[model samples]
Target chain A: MSSSANEAAARASAVSEMGRTIPTDAEVPHPEGVRWGMVVDLDRCTGCQACVVACQAENNIALNEEQRVLERRAKTWIRIERYWEGEFPNAKARFIPVLCQHCGNAPCETVCPVWATYHNNEGLNVQVYNRCIGTRFCANGCPYSVRYFNFWNPEWPEPMNNQLNPDVTVRTKGIIEKCTFCVQRINRVQVTAKTEGREIRSGEVQPACAQSCPTSALVFCDINDPESAPAQLAEAEAGRSYTLLEHFGTDPGIIYLKKVDPHAEIHEDEHAHAGAHA
Target chain B: MQEPVVADTKTSNRELLDFVFAWPAWFFAVGGALNGLLVAAFVVVILMLMFGLQFLGYSHPVYWGFLIVNFVFWIGVSHAGIMVSAILRLTQAEWRRPVTRAAEVLTIFSLLTAVQFPLIHSGRPWRTMYWTFPYDWNRGAWPNPRSPLVWDPSAIFTYLTSTILFVYVALLPDLALARDRAPNPVSRAIYGVLAMGFRGTTRQWRIQTVAGLLLSAIILPIFVSVHSIVSWDFAVTSVPGWHNTIFAPYFVIGAVHSGVSAVVTVMIVMRYAFGLKRFITRDHIDSLARLLIVVATVWLFFFLLDFFFGLYGTEPAEVDTWQRRLVEPPWVVIAITFIICAYIIPVPMWMFRAIRRNFFWMFVTTILVNVGMWLERYMVVVPALERKSGLTFTYGDYAPSLSEFILVAASFALVILGFLTFSKLLPIMPAADIKEGQILADRIRVGRANVPAAMRE
Candidate 1:
C-alpha cells in the first residue's frame, strides 16, 4: 500500500475508536444489565404523604399554594391520588402515589416536537429542561397524568428560599415538569463509585421517595442486577405484581403489588382494587 | 371580426378601476380602529408571557385550550382562498372572476394569523424560534423528525409562501392597468414596480397563463397535505378521541365546507362594499351556495363515519369519549349547535334557490355555517383532552379565560385589517379576468330559449 493510503487507514481506525467512547445503542447494551426500576407495595402503603414531601424537597418542585390548587393549576411532581370504592356508608378509600412511570415505550418522548424528553440506556426517561418549548403535547400524551406544567414562575419566599435543592433546576413558567427518580442522587452515587474504581452495588442508590416511605412501601433498585431488591421482589411477587395500565402497552418500569384483603369480593360489578387505578 | 362581448366588458372596466383608486374614508376609519385593537391585544399577550401563562386558563389535563382551537379554526378558514381561486380557475368556472381575488386575500391573511398560535402557545415563546429551526451545529442537536409538530412548521411555511406567490402572479395584469391609469407620479412609480415591466404582449400573457396553471396544479396537493398534517397533529397522538384514523378526511371535508361558505360571505360583502353588483352577479352567489351544500353533505358524511367508529368500536376509551361527549351537559349543547349551524339548517336553507339569491339570507346562512364550523373545531380539540383516558381521576373541564377571549377577537381584527389594507393597494375585482370571461360568455339562442354559453377557446 502507498504511504498516504496507510495513513488514511490509521486515521479511520482512530475515529472509529473515538466514536466507541460516545455510547451508541449498539455499543451500550448496558453490559452490566443496569436497568433501574421501582416497586410500590399497595398492601403496605398507608397514604401518609411523607414520600410526596421528600420528592418536593429533593426535586425543587414549585409550591402548591391553596389558590393554585383551587384553580386546578398546582404543580406536583408526585402526589397521592385517592379514589373511593363503594356506597358512602361502606366506602373504602384507596391511595396511589402517582408519578412519572418512565415507560420503556414512552409515548411522551415520541410526540415531543423538540425532543425535550428521551429514554436513556439505564432505562431512564430523561427530560431536557432547556429543549422543551412547552407545547404541552407531552403532558397530554402521558396517560398517567403525572406530568405537570409550571403555570407561573416558582416563588420561594424569605427563609424557604434557602431550602431549595441546588442539584435540581427550579423550572420557570411555561415548561412541563415531572419526577426524575432523584437523578441527581443517581449521578452522585455513580460518580463516587467511578472515582473509587468500583461498580455500583445494589440498593446503593435510594430515591428520596423510597428513602422517606415510612412503611417501606416504595423501593428503587437496578432490575438488571440479579441481587437487587427490586429485581428479586418483582420476581417473587409475580403473582401479585402487575403494572398500571398494562392494556396501554406503555411497559412502565414501575410495578405495583395488589392490596391483600381476604374480605374483598371478586364479582362482575365490583372490582376489588380497580379503585386504586381509578 | 370584433366580438360584441368586448364592448360590454369595457363598460364596467373604468368603474372597477375607479373603485380601488379612490380610497374611502369610512373604510380607513374602521380598519384603523381594528389595527389599534390588535396592537393592544398583542401588547397584553406579551406582558402575560412575562408574568406567567396562568391568565390563559390552561391546567393539567386541559393543557391546550382556546389557543389551539383558534389556530385550527383560522387555518380552516384559510382553505377558502384555494377552493375559490385555484379549484374554480382550473375548472374554468366563468363566475369565479369577481370572487377569486377576495377569497385568495382571505387565505393569505388568515394563514398569517393561524401561524401565530403555535408561537404564542409555546411555554417559552421566545425560544420557539430555535426549537423549530433544524440547525444545531453548536449544540449538536436537531429537531425530532418523528414528531408531527415538527412537520407543522414545514407544511405551514410552504403553504404560506406558495399562496403568496400565487396571489402576486395572478395580480400582475391588473396591476399593469393600475399603473397606466395612475393620476399621480407617486402612484405610477409604486404600481409600475409591482407590475414588473409587463408590456401586455401576447407572449407575456401566454407565459403568465402557463405559470399560473402550473402553480395552481402544484398548490392543489400541498393544500390537501397541509390540512391532513394539521389533523395528524391530533390523530398521531394516543389520546382516545384524537387518535382516530378518520381525522384526515374529516378535517379536509370540513375545511371545504367552511371555506366555500366563507367565500360566499366575502363575495356578498364585497358586492356592496365595491358596488360591483353588475360584476359579481347574483349567479355567482348562487353557485357558491350550491357548492357549499355539496361540501356540507360530505362533511356530514365524514362526521357520521367518525361518530360511528367511536360509538361501535370495541375500544373502551374511544367508546367512553363518544358517550360522555354526547351525554355530558355543556358538550351536549355544543354538539347540538354544531349540527344545526354547520349542516342541518344551512344545508336546507342553501337548497332553496330564492334563499341563495337573496343577499341578506345568503349572508346570514354563510355566517351561521362559519360559526358552526368554529364550534366543531372547539369540540374536537377540547373535549378529547378533557376526558383523556387511563386516569379517570384526572379528567377535568376547560373554560376559556378573559385573556383567551381577547386573543380570539384580536385574530379576527388582524384578518380584517390585512384584507382592508390589500384592497386599497391593489384592484381586488380581477377586472382583466372578468373582461376575458365576458368575451367568452356571449349569449346563444337554442330553438326557443336564450342561454349563455362560455366558449372554451
Candidate 2:
C-alpha cells in the first residue's frame, strides 16, 4: 500500500479514537514540500525596536511596568536582543531580534514533564498552556532565554483588557510561555485555506516581526519551496547565513544573516610581487 | 508530662517549662517585629524618595542595591536550616532528634522570607507572579525561561516542596506522639490532623524512614543546587563582582554557617526556654558551634581564593569590581567587620571550650555570625552594582522602596506565624527519633560495659 493509504488507515484509527466526528472523508493533503524557515539580516536591523512593539501588539504581551523592569522581572515573548561588540574607540554595538528558533531538535519539547509543548509537523514549536502544570523544566532546559513564565496573574486594567486576543487563552497565574510562531494566526490561516480547498500559500501568513520589518531584514517563509525569498536570500550569500549556537545541534528554524563587514582589509599575495620582491 | 495535673498543684510543671523555653519564640518574635519595623521605616523613606520628597533613592548606577542585598541575605539564612536537617539525617546524628524539627521549620520560613525579598524587591508585590505564568496564554507573550530569574524560582519551588515534605514526613510520628500526649481533646484533635493518622508500627517507621532518607538524598543535591542556582543568578550575569567561581561553594558554606548558627541559636533558646537541659545537651552545642566556625573558615577561604584568582585574571571588569568591593565606604567597612566577626574571629574563640560551652557567648556568636553572613550577601549583591562596569558603563542604584520594606516585614511575619502555628500543632522534635536515640545510647552503654576484665585477660 502507498504511504497515503497508510495515512488513511491512521486517520481511520484517529477517527475511532475521536468517536467519529461527522462523516469521515479524512483524505487531507500531506502539506507537501513545506519546511518553514526564517532569515534574519542583522546588517539591515537598525535596533529601532519597531519589531519589538509589533510582535508584542500582535501577540498581546503584557506590559511590565517600571517596578517589574526594576526588579529585573519584566516578561517579553520577543524582544530586540541588544549586545555590545568591540571596545571603547572602535566599539560598535549590535542588536539582534531574538526569538524562538523553532528548532527541529528543540530542547524545550523533550523536558516538558507534562508534554505541555511539542513540535508539530510544520516546524513550529507549540505550547499548550492549559495542559501545563507550570513546572518550568523547559525554561531551564533552553539555552536561549526565549521562554518566559507567567510569574503572576496578568492584569490589563480597564481598556487594556479589551485589547486581548479572543483567539488565545488568557493564561492563569502559574504556567510557562514562549513564542508560539503565532500559532493562533497559523490555525486561522490553516482553517481558511482548508475552507477554500487549497494548500497554504508560501507568503500567506508571515509572523508579525517579519511583516513589521521596514528594511525587510526579517523574512519568514517555507524553505522547502526553493522559490521562497528567504531560501533564495540564504542561497545568494555565504557572508549571511548562520544560526545562533549552532554547535549545540538545535537546527533552528530561525536563521540569522551574519552582520556584513564592509571594511574588511584585502591583503596582496606575495607571488604577484615575487618578480621583484622575491 | 501531663498539664491537667497542674490544676491540682500550685502550677503545672509542663506549662511553666513551656513558658520559660518559649523565650526564644518571644525574642525571635520581638526581634523579627523590630527588624520588620526597620524594614517598613526604610520603605516609607524610599516611598518618599520615589515621590521626590527625599534627595535620593535607587539611581542609574545601581538599579538593585539594598533590596537585592536583603534578598540574598535571607536566602543565605534559609540554606543552613535545610542543610542541618538533611545532613543530620544523612549522617544519622542521633543528637539531631531534638533539633531537626526546628531547623526544618526554619528552612521553610527562611525560604518564605527569602522568596519575598525578590517579590518586594520589585516594590510591586501584587504583580510578582508575572514572572511565573502571566495571563496571556498566547506565544510571544510569556515569561523568559532562559533567564536566571526563571531558573531561580523553579529551583526555589523545588526546594520548598522537598523541604516541606521533609518536615511534614518527619513530623508524622511526633504528631502522633503529641496527639496521644496532648493535655486536652482540642490539642489532640489538632495534632491528629497534623499527624495524618500515623501509628508507629515497625512497617510505618521503616517506610517513613526510607522515604525520608530518599527525600534527603534528593533534597541535599537540590539544596546545594538551589543556592548554587541562586548564586548563579549573580554569577551568570555579566556584572564583575557578582560573577565568580567561588560563589557556588562559598554561598553553600555561608549558608551552612548561617543555618548552623541559627540552629544553635534556636537550641540555646529552647534549652533555657523549655528547660530542655536533658534533651539538648552541651555536646550538641559544642559540636555544632565548632562545626560552624570551621564552615565559616571554609567560606572565608573560598572568598579569598576567588578574590585572588579574580585579581590574577587581571580582567578589567574583575579588577574594577573588586576595587569597588574593597574600597567602598560605610558598606565596605561594615562588610569587612562582618566577615571578620562572622568567620575569622569566631574560629579562635570557638576553639575555646568556655566560649563554645557558655550559652551567652554561643548566642552572641551565632547572632554575630548570621549578621556577618547577611553582610557577606550584601557585599556580594550591592557592591558590584555600586560602581560602573569594566567598560566604565553604569548600571543602576537601588534603594528599596517603602512597599518593598513592608512586604519584607510581612514575609518575616509570615514565617513567624507559620512556625508558631506549626509548633502549636506538633512537637518540634521527633519523639520516635528521640526514643531510637535513647535505645542506641543504651545499647552503646551496654556494649561498652560488656568489655569485661575477663575478656582483657
Candidate 3:
C-alpha cells in the first residue's frame, strides 16, 4: 500500500475510534455539513480567563458584579473552572474552560416549552431570546450547568454601556442566556463568503473565546470538514481527545484534549478522590 | 360502627345556610387579613415585572425555589377533593357525605392558587402566553409537546375544569335549597340561576346521582395524573435527586397524604366556623384520620424508596445530592423536620382512636403534616439544584427572598379567602347531602340493643 493511503486509513480508524467511545442515541446524528465545533487543549490553558472576558464583551453579557458573584448568580458565558490535583504540599492548580457544548441532542433544546432553544442546521444551539418565558426547565436539564439565567436587567453603568456589542442581543432579565459559540461571527463570515461566491475557509470563523485565547489553547473549526486543520489535529491527537460528560451521550460538539500530567500517580489519586467526593 | 344521628331537613338547611345568610365577625376579620396579604403579593408581582426575577432568591444553578415548592404544595393540597369526594363516593364510604363539598371546594380554590405560581415564577411572567397559549401564529411555532412545562398546563387546566364541573354538579341541590331559603330576592334570584332550574323529581335526582358517580369515576385518573405530571416537572429532569423512577408514585401518594390531611384541617374549621356540630362529627374526623394513616404510611414508603434509589445508583452526583439533603446543615434540619411533621408525629398519633377523634389534635396534627409536606417538596427541589452536577465549583445554596416568602404566605391566604367567599355565597356543607344521609338512616335491633344502621342503595 502507498504511504498516503496508509495515513488516510489511520485517520479514518482514529475518527471511528473516537466515534465508538462517544455513544449517541438515534435522536442525535452528525449533521451532513459545516458542523461547528471546538477543541480545547487543557495542557496549554493558563487559567488566565482572557477568553471569559472576551466572551462577555462580545456577547453583550450582563455585568457580573461582586454581589452577583457572592450570590452565585453571575453570568459568564465561558468560565475557567479551577481544580486542585493534590493536597497541601503537592497541590497543582488545574484549569478547564467550561461552556455550552452545543450538543447534537441538546437537553436544553428538548426542555424549552416555547422552542426558545433549538439546534440550527449548522450544529449551533440557537436560543431565541424573545420566545423564552423563563421557565428555567432547560437550565435544570443541562448536565454541564453552563446555562445561565438573567436574574436582573443588565446594567453597564454609563460609559461601559457604550462598549456593548451591537451584533449580539443583550438578553433581558428572566430569560436564559448561554454560550452560542459566538454565532454572530459565524453568520458574518457565512454571509461574507456567500456574497463573494465562495465556501467559508477553514479557521475563517473564530468565536470570541477562541480568538482571544493568547496561547491558542482553544481552537475553533468545522468538525465535519476533514481538511480543517483543527479537525485533523483533533483526529491526530485522538488518544487524548474526550468530550465533557461522555456518559450522558449528548454528542457534544466541543472536544477537550486531556491535560498532560507528568506525574500520573498524583492524577490517578486525584481522580479517585474526586470520585469519592462526588 | 356507630351510625351518625342525622339532622332533619329544616335544621340542616338553617345550619348549613347560616354562613351564607349572616356575616360572621371572624369571617370579615380573617377575610380582610387574607385580602391584605394577597394585595401585598400583587405588589410583589408588579415589582418582579418591573425589576426582574432579582426579587426572587434564584441564583445561578438554583433557578427554582419557594414559588415552585408552593406550586407543588398547593397542587398537592388540591388532591383532597378527589380523594374525599370521588374516591370515597366510588367506594360508597358512608362518612363522606358532609365532607365532600368542603373537600371539592378546597380543590377548586387551591388549584386556582396553584396555577398562578408557574405564571408568576417565570422570569418574564408577562410573556407566559408564549409558554401556555396553544400556538404562536406570528412565528408559526407551536409550544413544544416534548417539554414537561407544556404537559403541566394541559394537565392542571384539565383537572381544574373537571373539578369545577364536579363541584357544580354536586352543588345543584344545595343551590336549590339556598334559593328557597335565600333572605332577599337578589340572593334568591342569584341562587336560582346557579341552580339551573332543577326541581326535586325522581328522574332529576337519578340523573344527578349518576352524574356525580360518573364525574367521580372520570376525575379519579385526572387526580392521579395531575400530581404525577407535577412530579415529572422534577423527575423527568437529569437533576440527580429529582431523576428517580419512584418520583411519580411518590408525588401522587405524598399529594394524597398532604391533601387528605388538608381536608381534615378544613373539615375541623368548617365544623366550628359554621356551627356544624351535627354533620361534621368526631366520627367523620376519625374516619378521615384512619384514611390518612394508610396514605401517610404509603407516602413514607415512597419517600424511603426515592431516597434509597437516589443512593442506590451510587453515581457521584446522585450521592452528592443525597449527602447535601441528608448531612448538610440547614438541609439536614429541613429533612428531619419533614420526617417528624409528615410522618413521625402525625401518623403515630393518628393510630390512636382518641387522638383521631379529638378535633384539636386532628387539626394541629393535620396542619403539621402539611408543613412537613411543604418542607419535603422544598428539600426535594432546592438541594438537588444546589448540587446539580459533579462540577462542584458550580454548586450553590439558595435561600428564598422576602418576596418569595410573601408570595408563599399569600397562597395560603388566597385559598382561605377563596373558601370564605365561596362559603358566603353558597353552603360550604351540602344540605342536600345531609338530608340524603338522614333518609338513609335506619335502626336495627340486635340482642338487647337497638343499633343505628345505614340503608345502602
Candidate 4:
C-alpha cells in the first residue's frame, strides 16, 4: 500500500479500537448472580412507618412537617400505603411500603424533556439531579405519587444540617426528587467491587430500609439472578407478590408481597384496608 | 418600541388605549395581595400543623386534604390561560388579540405556580429527583416514558413553548412599532433587541402571519392535550371520580370557561384603567361576553353529562361523589350555588344587552364566573377522595396552609408583578395590528378587493 493509505488504515484501526474499548467510568458492575430489587412481605408488614423513617434517615429526605403534610407537601421517599379490604367489622388494613418501584418499564423516564431520568444497567431507575429542570412532569405522570418536588430552598437548623448525605444533592425549589433505592450506596458497592477486581456478592449493597428491617419484611436482591434471595422469595411467593398500580402498564421495579389476609376468608363487613380493588 | 403598522381609525385613540390596560395591574396587585394574604395565612397554619404534628401526630390518613385540594385548584386554574389563547387564535377570533396575551401569560405563569405544589407538597422538597432514571454521570439510567409524571414535562414543555412562541410572534410587529415610536434611546434599544430586527414590510408581515397561524394551529391541540393529560394524572388512576372517561373534554371546556371569564375580568379592568374606550370598545366587551356565555353553557353541559353518567351507573363511590357534591349532609346547596354561579348565572346575565352594556354587571359576572370555576374544580377533586372507600373524613377538611397560601398569593402577585414590568417595557396594544386593522376597515369601505398599500407598510 502507498504510505498515506497505510497511515489512514492505522488511524482507522486506532479509532475503531477506541470505540470498542469498555467504558470504565459509566458502568454498574453487576454482582455475581445478582439483580437489585425490593420485595416487601405484606404478611409481615404492620404498616409501621419504620421503613419510611429508616429510608429517610439513610437518604436524608427532608422532614415533612404538618403543614407540609397538610399541603401534601410532605415528602416520604418511601411510604407505607394502606389499602382497605372488606367492610367495617371485617375490614383489614393491607399495609405496603410504596416507593419508586424502580420499574423495569418506568413511566417517568420517557417524558423527560432533558432526559434527566433513565434506567441503569442493574434495572435501577435513576435520576440525574443536575440535568432535571424542575418542571415536575414526571411527578404528575407517575401512577403512584412517589415523585416529589422541592418547592422552596430547603432549610435545616444549625448543626442538624450537617447530617445531609454528601452523596445526594439537597434539591432547591422548583425541581422534582424521589427515591433512588439508595443508588449512592449501590454506586459505592460497585466501586468497592471494581477496585478489588471482583463482582458484587449476594446480600451486599442492601438499601438502608431492607438492611434495617427488624422483621426482615423488606428484602432486596437481584430478581434476575435466580439464586438471589429476593428472586427466590419472589418465586416462592408467586401468588402473594405484586406491584403497585400494575394496571397502568408501568412495570415497576419494586415488588410487593400482598398484605396477607389471614382473615381474608373470615373478614367481611369490617374490612378497613381495602386493596385498591376499586 | 412598537411600530405603527395600521393607522388608528377611531376618532379617539390614546385615551382609550392607555386606560383599558392600566387597572388590571392595580386591581391584580391589590386583589392579588389580599388573596395572597389569605393564602399566606393558610400556608403558615399548614406548616405549623405539619411541624407541630411531630409531638402528637394523628395517624388516620397520612396524605390528606389541603395538599390534594391545592393540587386540584392550581391545576384547574392553570387550564384556562393556554386553552383560551390557543383555541381562540386557532379559531380565528380577532377579539382574542387584545385579551390573548394576558390569557396566555396567565397560562405560563399559572403553570409555574401550580406545578410547585407537588414538590412543596412533599414535606421535604429536597431530593425530589429520585424519580428520574439516571443522573449526569450517564450511568444509562433515565425516567420511564410511560408514566404521567414523565409525560407531564413533555406536555407542559410543549404547551409552554407554543404559548411563548405565540406570545413572541404576535408581539414582534408591536415590538418594532415600539422601537420606532420610542421617545428615548433606552426604550428604542430595548424594543430593537426584543423586536429581533422586525420591519413591517410585506414579506415580514406575510412571514410572521404565516408563522403565527402555524403556531396557533399547532398550539390548539397542544393546549387541549395538556389539560387532558393533566386530567389523566388523576384519570389514569383507578380512583372512582378521577378515572371517568369524560375527564378530557370536561377539563378542556372547564378551562375555557374559567379562562374566558378571566379574560373578561382583565379586559374590564383594562377598560377602566387604561381609558381604552375605543380600542377595547363596547363591541369588544360584547364580543367577549358572548363568548364567555357559550363557554359557561358548555361547562354546565359537560358537568351535567358527567353527573348523569355517574348517576346512571350508580357506582357507589361515584354516587357518593355526586351526593357529596349535590345531596350530602353538608351544604350541598352551596355546591350547587357555586356551579350556578360559574355556569348558570353567567349566561343569562351576559345574554341581556343591558348586562353586556353595563360595566358593573360585566365585572360582576366575570368575577362570579372565575369563582364558580374554582368551586367546580374543588367539587370535582376534593370530594372524590375526601370520602374514599365509603367512609367520609368529614373532620379532615382542607384549608390552604399558610405557606402554600402565601406561595399561591405570590404566584398571582408575581404574574401581576411580571405584567407590570412587561407593560413598562412593551406596547400594551398591538399598535401595528390595530393600525393595519384600521387600514383594512378603510379598504373595505373603499370597495378595494385588496388591503390598502399604506397599511402593508
True contacts kept of each: 0.72, 0.00, 0.78, 0.07
Better model by lDDT: candidate 3 vs candidate 4: 3
**Runs in model 1 lying further than 4 Å from the true structure:** A1-32, A265-269, A272-278, B1-9, B443-457
Better of 1 and 2 by DockQ: 1
Q: How much lDDT does each candidate structure score? A: 0.82, 0.67, 0.87, 0.64
In angstroms, give how far residue B206 of model 3 lies from its true place: 1.2
Note the DockQ of each predicted structure: 0.53, 0.04, 0.41, 0.08
Docking quality band of candidate 4, CAPRI definitions = incorrect
Pairs that collide in candidate 1 are none
Q: Write the per-residue lDDT of candidate 1 for residues B1-457, one digit (tens) a residue.
A: 1123533745656877866688788897988889888987887688778876878878878899888989988889889999888998898776787888899999999999999988898888887765567655344456777788888889888999999999888889999988988889999999999999987899999988888888888899988988899999899888888988999989988888888888888888888887776777678788888888888999999999999888776676777678667778888998899889998888898889999889999999999999999989988988888888857778878889888888898998998888877887898878777777776767888999977666565
Q: Cα lDDT for residue B407, model 3? A: 98
Residues A1-278, candidate 4, lDDT per residue (tens digit)? Answer: 67975675566456446542211212333333234788878778877788888887777778777777765667788887676755899666666677788876665665554556766657777776766665454564455657776655678788969988888778765556788888888889999999999988987978888887889899887777787787788888887666765556677667777655655555533333333331
Residues A16-73, model 2: lDDT tens digits? 5654321123322124535567888888998887777777777877777898676644
Tell me how far the alpha carbon of residue A72 in candidate 2 is from the true structure, in angstroms, after superposition.
Answer: 7.5
List model 4 lDDT by residue over B290-365, tens digit each.
Answer: 8777777777889889888888876665677677778875538658778778867778878899889777888898
Error at A168, model 1, angstroms: 0.8
Docking class of 3: acceptable
> What's the alpha carbon RMSD for model 4?
9.0
Query: Candidate 3 residues B1-457, lDDT tens each?
Result: 4346576667777888888999878988998999999999999999988888888888888888999999999999999999999998888786788899999999999999999998998888877777677876565467888788999998999999999999999999989988988889998999999999889889889999999999999999999999999999988777888888899999999999999999999989988888888788899999989989999999998888888898888888999999999899999999999999999999999989999999999999999999999999999999999998888878888998999999999999999999989998888887787777776665678899976555565
What TM-score does prediction 3 earn?
A: 0.94
Q: Tell me each candidate's TM-score.
A: 0.93, 0.60, 0.94, 0.64
Give the candidate order by descending TM-score: 3, 1, 4, 2
Predicted structure 3: lDDT: 0.87
